[model samples]
Target: MGQSTTPVLDRVGFAMLSIIMISVLVTASSVFGTSSNPKGVSIPLQERGSPLAKDGVIIPEALARLAYWDAAKQHAKINNSGPPNNSSSLFRRHSAPLESKLDDILWVGEIEIGKPRQRFRVDFDTGSSDTWVFSSTCVAPICSSKNKYIASESSTSTLQVGEFKKDYFDGTEVSGPIYADTITVAGLSAEGQWFSPIDQVNNMEDYGRDGLMGLSFMSISQLKAPTFIGTLLSQKKISKHIFSMRLSSGSGSELFIGGINPSKYRGELTYVPLESQTMWIVKGSASANGRNGFNGNMVIDSGTWV
Candidate 1:
């Protein structure tokens, strides 16, 4: 006779069913879902174990969210992955990274910058190369709302070079100029994190957010600024070949720098060759008897899902 099913196993069954179904639904190329939009976030991965595990799958949204938050709370940083704490050098300094702190996790949260201090996060996007918020001049809330706007009014150096009257995938066609601003994330600061000075649009409303931070792993600066990962890799940080990332359900998640406990990842991880400024990418090999693969350029970006 077949064994009886536990409530836990039953729940796991449901979650797997949901994810597979959603993947199928979005896989169609012609009717492909617009991932560029809000509802387009990828289906959450299994919370704890392999999606195929009988007792390991997690399908519920609540469960997935909880897992991500749990991961972030347990966050740590990348410091020379090979050894004991070595802060004596430029790259070896290790501190409990802000990635662990609540502020770094922004499913939706506030970010204050500049003298006037602009605040908003509703349309936060990780795919874009720029970071912007609304202002008084902006019809968005980052501007006139009693809330706050980055007081560009106080900065000593400012650039109004990048202006956009165009709409982004988020559906907000905001008017603003890209300028240089000192930015702070969970108390960690970037002296020249690119920012914008523009007012919020009046009609725009997100589930409600303070602002967006670009986690896409691209360099927007002419000088080629460091990426979220490269920033950690500087000088003496980390020695691990890879780190694990768990984007939990809620706004928080962890980028386990050195490594994620192996118990988490399920499928095989493909390591594309790393290109210095090109980021993470590897060349695909040719068929057994065929010619070598394309000698073309392939830049590796961790933010890329495909």
Candidate 2:
């Protein structure tokens, strides 16, 4: 959300400082109610990246970042939704590690679906409100190396009447049929969760993860169904409607579901009220390394490095 005309700081440095400062600014906000003590689920994050080039050359950070921003912007245009209601109640905690790729540009974590539990790694994106993954019907070259969800294999899988398609800024798309099944993340299960089972991938190359788990509000969801987190809240799977992510250069990153880990962060938590509910939009000013900065509405997006 904060940018500098001069190259005041690199991406990683700026990201770290922003995260910490934001945490301090929005820690005790009413969004995370003060009614009850919230338990934290700490998931460790892993580091990963796209496949090497034909000549075994890694992609440059600037180019990779550009691609990410394009995708994030495309997602932003999807829709607008209101903020979710949050209640601070006790709930069980589940923890897992996330995978970080390309100099902490991409953060992915494991999730399981179906009765028998087909596992896959997904990028938990907050910029979008749709959760989608490759399906067994997908025969695209891009999906050949990723895990595909097989509806027939899961007795709990129900075919929903609808099609799902997402267009990116680059004109590439990933789409498929919708399904409602049991989705498990970090040991917490949300039954009858509706998500797109991607069977068609057009010009959309792999991004080191099987699919994406959108953590934003459901109003932007393409399926018109509750987002995974929303489903969990409605189903009473997690009493607290709170989750947080800690990103870094590589490794040591984590996704805290259900609540925030007090151990991971110290000092009094500051709560910055949201300016808008559609996304994590907050009005705040940012500075780089004690230099001059700008003030405006900032979208706290984890889907891309802005």
* Model 1 Cα shift for residue 204 (angstroms): 4.4
* Candidate 1: segments with Cα more than 4 A from true spot: 1-106, 115-124, 140-147, 164-166, 200-205, 217-245, 250-306
lDDT of each: 0.32, 0.61
Tens digit of per-residue lDDT, candidate 1, span 1-306? 121122321111000101111111122010110111111112121111111112333436434433342222112111102222322121110111112121112233335565444444332233343465555455433344434344546463366554544333213444566655555433333444455545534323232333444443343322234433233223224332223334443322333333333333354333333222222222323333576744533322212111
Q: Number of the top candidate by TM-score? A: 2
- Model 2 whole-model lDDT (C-alpha atoms): 0.61
How does candidate 1 score on lDDT? Answer: 0.32
Q: How many pairs collide in each candidate, listed in order? A: 41, 19
The total number of steric clashes, by the backbone 3 Å criterion, in model 2 comes to 19
For candidate 2, give the lDDT of residue 287: 89
**In candidate 2, what residue range of length 10 has the lowest lDDT sum?**
87-96
The alpha-carbon lDDT assigned to residue 163 of candidate 2 equals: 93
Using lDDT, give the best candidate's number. 2
